[model samples]
Target chain A: MKQMRRRRVRRALEEQCFLWLMRLSLLGAVGVLGMIVGVICWRGAGALSWEMVSSLPEGGFYLGREGGILNALVGSLYLACGATVLALCLAVPVVFYLHTYASPGGRLRHGVRLALDILWGIPSIVYGAFGFAWMVYLGVRASLLAGILTLALVVLPILARTLDEVVEMTPVLLRESTLALGATRLEWMGVLLRQSLPGLLTAILLAFGRGIGDAASVLFTAGYTDNLPDSLLRPVASLPLAVFFLLGTPFPEVQARAYAAALILTIIVLGVSVSAHLSLARLGRYVIR
Target chain B: MGGVVEQPDKGSQRSESFRLSGRRRWSDRVAHRLLGLIAGALCLLVVGVAAALLLRSLPLLSTFSLFELWGGQVWQPMRGLFGYAPFVVGSLWVTAVAMAVAVVPAVFSGIYLAEYVSERGRALLKPLLDLLVGIPSVVYGVWGVLFVVPLVRDWIGPWAEQTVGDALPFLGRTSPSGYGLLSAGLVLGIMVFPLIVAVTEEVMRSVPREMREALLSLGATRWETTKCSVRRVGLPGILAAVVLGFSRAFGETLAVMMTVGNVAQFPSTIFDPVYPLPALIANNYGEMMSVPLYEAALMHAALLLLGVVIIFNVGARLVIERLVRRIR
Candidate 1:
């Protein structure tokens, strides 16, 4: 009886110890996130100004003598938008086919999912390398078009898989009813599209967020230029690369601008993510669960 | 006789409907073919990426034996000597260190969220974790350069050297600049933390409630039940999560490049500077065209990175699939 009581005490102590350890680990994990945002905001707010967001860089921008990062701001918007549209065009059809035409739990469907998962895992750097190789073969220059194409490839799997998950969640009874009502496969796809509209929006926003924030895939394909992007053929600057290049310079002023650029990119990503989360909840009212 | 009669009646009714909705039937068939074609094209694109990398890398392979490339240490593109040992080792060191720093804490945090937190807490915390995951890798890189590198240079490195230098010789040599494996690994650990946590929590939550209830009825403590029931059942899935995180860290470029110091050498200590494969490709692409076989060498690096990541990703996916099947 004495030994059993001691054993009980030991067990209780062990439980408490582990529970505290887990709590501390949780705190540490959240603290890192807090620190990242805190540091960026503290440094970036000081350097941010109306001129920084509104004006383009001048002759001595890299030297920290003049101008703003309007070129990168607009360039990132254009690249991300273009890539999102391209990826959507490809992703939608593939998703529709997987749900409608392919048999449920069949090898083809599984293989496609597996393929997409692998694609999603391929690093942005490899996509950039592959883009560079293709451009060389096609004798194409590093430009906005090249960047969009490569970024599209990078986000395609993400868009597809996210949309796939949402579509997969759709009730099978709905499909059966639609088919039983003498609807063709194409018509059923229309219903699926309408039902998954919120999911589609979420996927687009997520892909755009990923595309705009990516630096590596665009490093080689989208050659950075100081000027605002005027044509698809022209090289374009991006906010992430802006941070990279500016931070590498010797001038403190330049590094400060890098922080500001990073701040802008972070805000954009944060907004996209929050909206993606919020929109799902808000629009999910119409969804059949 | 009744089944045969019903089958003929159904076939005639289907034919009649098809004849009545002829245009709709045509449109459906056309759409199906078109969508299937797109899906097929997507599959082809995946294969194309791998093939293109392999073909582009062939030139370098033709010039150097696989053994020479893998084992060589000199990496002077200007001098026409290509060696991958340093970069390979550098990647290994950074990834290994990052996994070490991240896995335990992340798993603990994940378990805390899954088993200990209230529903409201989980709801609030999950989106925050998602936000962390969405933060750009470049931002993480900048954070590393500004905060982590300085912290390491000033405090962690010197403190470790003084305290543990005699006991472990590896801790004796500190990189003066603080831009080395340890800084990169720490930064990467933070970067991959949310990912591992999200996955692990998901895996743990997938464990059946009945199992927990049964254990609790037998007089097990909450922690004891979790250890025996949830952890054991979710072990393979947690492993898959870790592998996924490993693959992610291995292929990350700009962030690792920024903090890793980009020195092409086999690091003797955690503080020593090192170069990784993705960094090699990203940094040298601009100048690669000027040197013979330089572009091919970089392509080979990309191919190597892609090949390894694919293997890991496929393995993890298969494991998760098997686990799901077993659970069902």
Candidate 2:
């Protein structure tokens, strides 16, 4: 009886020790990551103000008083918006036709997915390389048009994949109804496509979020110019570019500016994603698969 | 049986629908053929670039001997003798060190959001991590240059040298180049943290809850059970995540370029100047100069790096798929 009681007591002790160790291991890691995020935000938040957001990053974010991110912010908007529009225009018909009209035995669908997977798998630097070779090499220069064109390809796979599902989810009955009405192919496409526009727009927005925040694709093709972008051929400074440019400078104030810019970029991305989720919710009934 | 077989009325109608929808009209067939060809062409485009990287690198092969590129220690390229030893070693070492620093904290953040947190917390954080991944490397490069470089040199440098002494080669040296192995690794660790956390959380969520119950029922506390059940189950997924992170960190260019001191020699110490594979390419690719061979050498480096990354990526995908099946 005495020996058995002793054994049970030892087991209890072992269990308690293991539990304590695991708790410490998991929480300790959490503490360290939290510290990193906290330090960055605390240091960065103090450097931002309304004036910094409203003007150009002319000299740098020296005091959060002199230069602003207005130029970069506007440029990112234009480039991302243009790319998103172009990608959506190309993707919508391709996606719809693949789902609604194409035969199952066709290798076209398989090829489309394979192409997207490859595009997604390859590094963004390679895209920059291709853009440099094709556009910059041909003396097209590092301009906004080249930047948009590069980003469009970079984001096309992601946008196209998501939009394919959005189109696929549209009721077969809707297509059938149009077919029975003797409507021409284009007319049917117009009506059904219009009805699914909101969901399609959501996918485009997500791609825009990705495109706007991307720095690698723009580095070679877009180049850097501080002035407001005037023509499609002109180089532009984007928000991420501002952050990138600020890092290498000598000033402590400039580093602070990079952080503040990071904060803004984070907000814009969150807004885009939230809008996408809201749109996903708006797409009711067809939400099954 | 004869009546069923002879039912031609509805069968013909059904066959007609299938045949007409199946076989395309001339214009329809032309359009189908055209679109499929276009889509196929795009696939060819991506493959074409990857192939070009290989083809562009062919000239590099004639310049550097295989043995010299792999096992040789010296990297004196100025005299036209190219050795890839320092770069390959540095890339792998930095990647391993970075993953060690990265995995633990990333797991905590992921677990905090996935398991410990309430619905509100998950809603807020999932998007933040997504944003973190979206942020550009140039910005990260900037952060590394201004903040990470100084922190390493000023604080980490002195402490490491004093504590570890000459035993730690990289820490012992003092160089003008702020580019060091440890700092670059830390910056890279932060950069790829989100990918690991995101994928690990996904895999963990799929793990059944019964294993947790079985452990807890046998007197294991929630925390203890998690370590054994959830953690053990999550190990292979985390390992795959680490490989993916390593490949990215190893192959990365601009961020590592700006931060890592761009010296060509093999680093004797962490504080000594180090060159990574991607940095070598980025710095040289733009400045291919009158020496056409220099560009060829850089292309050679890109090809080797590409081969390594693709192998690791394909392996990780397979591992993750197997892990998923086993869990299911």
Candidate 3:
């Protein structure tokens, strides 16, 4: 009886220890995130300046010269927006095809999704290399156009998969009713579009956020320049690249500028993420199971 | 005679409707096939990327024998020494360190969130994990430089040099400057923590409630139930998560680049500087065009990186899928 009681006490102690360990792990994950964001904000705030956002860089910017990342900020927006638009155009049709045309849980649907998953898993740097190689073959230089095309390829899978998930959640009864009313396949697509509009919007925003934040993918393909890109053929600056470049320099001022660029990039991503989360929460009701 | 007449009239009307809709049905079929073709073409894009990488890297393959290119330790592109041993080893070491540091906490957190936490707590934790995922690598890189590197240099490095360093011969040769394999690995570990936790949580959640209930009824404690039944069922999935996280760490560029001092060497100690393939490419791609075989070498490196990552990801997916099938 005494031995049984001792065993029970030990088991209780072990359970408590296990629970605390698990909780500690949770705390660790949250702590790391909080620490990273906290440190970036603390350091980046000191570097943020009105002139930095308002004006372009002057001469000798890399050597701690007076300059702002206006060129990079504008370039990043152009690249991200362009990529998101182009990706949406391609992704919507593919997603629609998967849902409307393919049989439920068919081989073709599985194969296509598996392919997309593979593509999605391919690292961004690989996309950059592929883009660079393709550009060389096509006799095109690294420009805004090249960056957008490359980024589109990167974000296409993401947008398609997210939109596909939302579409798949759409009730089969809805589809049956629409078809029962003698709706054409094209018209059915319109119905799916209407139903998944909120989710689709969220997907686009998420893709844009991803495109804007990725640095390695565009590192070589974007071909950064000091001046703002006026034409699609010219090279462009981007926030990720700007942060990467400035951080490399030894100068304190330029390093601070890198932090500021990071802050802007983080803000954009955070905004998109929050908006996506909000939309998901609100529009979730419209989705029937 | 009346039934026969009605059947003939019905057949005639059906034929007329079929004829009337022929052109419309043809267009519909065409549209369906067209969209299917587009979707298939999207799948083919990955194959195209592989081909492109192979074609681009052929120049390097021609210059150096396959064995020589992969087997050589040095990677001086300017001097035409395009061996990839150091970079590959560097990548492996860093990823190993990251996995070692991250896997335990990630698995624990996954268990906590999936089995132990309240629904409200799970909701709060999940969004925070998403936030972690959304934070850019560049931000992590900057943070690493500001905090992690210094912490390692001043405290962790010295402590390790005194304790683990004395015990382990390789660790005895430590760098006073902390930015090296260990720092890069730790930062990568932190970056990958959320992904690991997320995957683990999913795998743990998929363990049916009945299994937990049965274990508890059999006089198993919550910990024992989780460790024996839940973890046993989810082992393959946990491994898949680790593989995925490892791939993420292996391919990570900017954060590793910033934290890893770009010395082209096989790190003898965790403190010693090392350079991975991604960093090598990112740092040198600009100057590569100027040099002769440099561009080819970088292409080769990219191809190698892609092959490794794709293999890992595809293999992990297969394992996870099998695990899901078994669970169902």
Highest DockQ scorer: 1
> DockQ scores for all the models shown?
0.80, 0.23, 0.72
The CA lDDT at A69 in model 2 is 81
Question: Which stretches in model 3 have alpha-carbon errors above 4 Å?
Answer: B1-27
**In candidate 3, what are the lDDT values of residues B47-164, reduced to their tens digit?**
9999999998898898789899889987777788888999999889989988989999998998889988899988777988887887777878988899989999998887877888
lDDT against the true structure, per candidate, is 0.91, 0.70, 0.86
Off by over 4 Å in 1: B1-20
Candidate order by DockQ, decreasing, is 1, 3, 2
Top candidate on lDDT is 1
Deviating ranges (above 4 Å) for candidate 2 = A1-71, A86-118, A135-140, A157-202, A251-267, A270-289, B1-42, B62-81, B107-125, B145-147, B166-179, B208-235, B271-273, B284-286, B325-328
Index of the highest-TM-score prediction: 1
What's the TM-score of chain A alone for every prediction? 0.97, 0.81, 0.95
Tens digits of per-residue lDDT, candidate 1, B22-133, equal 7888898889889878887887787899999999989999989999998999998888789998999999899999999999999899988999999999988888888888
lDDT of 1 by residue, A53-123 (tens): 99999989899877999999999999999999999999999998999998889877887888899999999
Chain B TM, per prediction:
0.94, 0.85, 0.92
- Write out the backbone clash pairs for model 2: B169-B269, B170-B269, B170-B270, B170-B271, B179-B261
Error of 1 at A229 (Å): 0.8
Model 2's alpha-carbon lDDT is 0.70
